[model samples]
Target: MSPKLDRIGSVHLTMRQVARATQNFSPSMKLGEGGFGTVYKAQLQDGQMVAIKRASKENFDSLRSEFRSEIELLAKIEHRNLVKLLGYVDKGNERLIITEYVPNGTLREHLDGIHGNYLDFSQRLEISIDIAHGLTYLHSYAGNARFCSAFGKCSNGEAMDLVDPQMREDVDEKIFKKMLNLSFQCAAPTRADRPEMQAVGEQLWAIRMKYLQLGREE
Candidate 1:
């Protein structure tokens, strides 16, 4: 095992094992595609369901360094909203990342009505708060430099505009504004001006609670 994999205590799987589990990357097993590569659903010998991300042959060499760095980073961070990295495979030209299977699907999929499930206003608020909490954990525990990329994305000051159209109507404007304000703070030009993740999480939780209380009174 490589030092990075050793540090993370990640399980190392052989190419044959991965191929067997994925039925040699059968089309039906393919889950999704991303910048990293293709994702597939696999069932391990022990009956554990996992999502495997395989790097494209064209990008394999170029992404090796990034893949290792990501493994090292993910191994050290643990959060409810963040997917857990279960293992990895690096053999010849093959590079793969294994993670726990999330059966419910992506938040975008739910919002887009892919699974016949639509989130209500309260549910959407809860999800927003969850994201804030996760971000808070990443910022506070992992150090600012480690999360600079994420911070940069929020720097454009268009955070509120990214809200889903389906969630626009029937929103608690008061709470929504509070969440928006928090986003701006997190995206502050100066890192010192940004509130610690703990504070961000607390504020988000408070907004969620306030919204829930108002719901109870109505």
Candidate 2:
């Protein structure tokens, strides 16, 4: 059974428990590796699957400080779109953080067409809105604001040319235009040209409603 993650809080996890869950840190169970550590797929004794990042001990002080920073930030966040911290293990040379497992892989993987198929327009729009909302929450409440954009060619009215050819038929060109147009508007070179945050939200809502209607039609 899947772990009831929503009800769980960050708890103490023993090295043995994590080691066992990760099948002795088997390479086959590894999901990915990043700056913090190698992430392995772990199944707890309670049948909950989670990602365990085993911090590298090579540079103890540096990695340990980063590990603590990560834990501090993730522990305070409780958003559906963000990964939730389940537990941590910090003892001796072992330092680890276990988070809720997300099996779908990264957005870059999907965008690169590594996943089965390219995402359609509606899916892309929904994803954009979800990311915006998540970032908005982080900026407003998490005390760490970070954002980026790539809207030069997009706002040039060539957004349709950027659509993945594989899923071109699945995409609604008009909606794609609206999405990219709003992206450019939000990222207007001059602050005066940019719409207010509230207006951006309202525009996204209208686009979302249109996407729903399009989905129902097809």
RMSD of each: 17.1, 19.1
lDDT at position 114, candidate 1? 89
Candidate 2 TM-score versus the reference: 0.55
Clashing pairs for model 1 are: none
- Full-model lDDT, candidate 1: 0.79
Span of ten consecutive residues with least summed lDDT in model 2 = 143-152
- lDDT of candidate 2? 0.75
Q: Model 2, 49-157: lDDT tens per residue?
A: 8898887767567766666555565676778887778777767787787888998987888887898889888999999999998887765454331112134456566
Q: Residue 13 CA error for candidate 2 (Å)?
A: 1.9
Q: Please name the candidate that would achieve the greatest lDDT relative to the true structure.
A: 1
Lowest lDDT sum, 10 consecutive residues, model 1, at 1-10
